[model samples]
Target: MSHSEQTIEREIVSKGLTAPRLTPTSIDEAIKDEHYWVAPGRRLTVCALTLRNGFIVTGESAATSSENFDEDLGRKIARDNAREKIWQLEGYLLRQRLHDA
Candidate 1:
């Protein structure tokens, strides 16, 4: 992995978020070629968390800039998005549980 990639990975882990694996799809490859200035493949980042009740939540983000794309930033954004969603769900579930009780 590149230095930037490693740094991003560490940052994700440090934040207690799982590092997303970069898996490029066919469309991502095509887009990369069409946009030569951009990286040659997709650096899609996704985050997922399993709640104590076996519920799963996820968030995803991708590199936006063709030039000077920062994997670290992308990962952070994705993880944050995921974390927000998780909290929202948690709040809703807790409210429902309390209402039922």
Candidate 2:
């Protein structure tokens, strides 16, 4: 993967998130959703949250931009990505709950 992608992968891992396997198909699948696109095609990102009370709260995005990067812009994008991830996880949990119910 590229430098930026590698950096993102490291950040995600450092944050204690899930790390998806590093493969073209895996990366493609993960990146299909904005929330899962934490790294480039070769870096794996993982979920870092624990389920509770039938609700799923996302831990955090593993990817972080450079220190010199624009903080405001990065924060905006991170917020959007985090929102998408939380919604995705919530949908999964809801489906599971419905099945269990």
Give the best candidate by lDDT: 1
**TM-score of model number 2:** 0.33
Provide the global lDDT of candidate 1 against the true structure: 0.51
> Residue 41 of candidate 1: its Cα lDDT?
59
CA lDDT scores, all candidates in order: 0.51, 0.44
Whole-model lDDT, model 2: 0.44
RMSD, candidate 1, Å: 13.4
Mark the regions of model 1 whose C-alpha exceeds 4 Å error after superposition.
1-40
Evaluated at residue 86, the lDDT of candidate 2 is 47
**Candidate 2 segments exceeding 4 Å error:** 1-68
- Give the per-residue lDDT digits (tens) of candidate 1, residues 1-101: 33554686678668887433331221122221110111355566665645555555566777664454566775666655655555455556556777797
User: Lowest summed lDDT over 10 consecutive residues: which window, candidate 1?
Assistant: 27-36
In candidate 2, residue 41 scores what lDDT? 39
Q: After superposition, how far is residue 85 of candidate 2 from its true place, in Å?
A: 1.1
TM-score of each: 0.50, 0.33
**What TM-score does candidate 1 get on C-alpha atoms?**
0.50
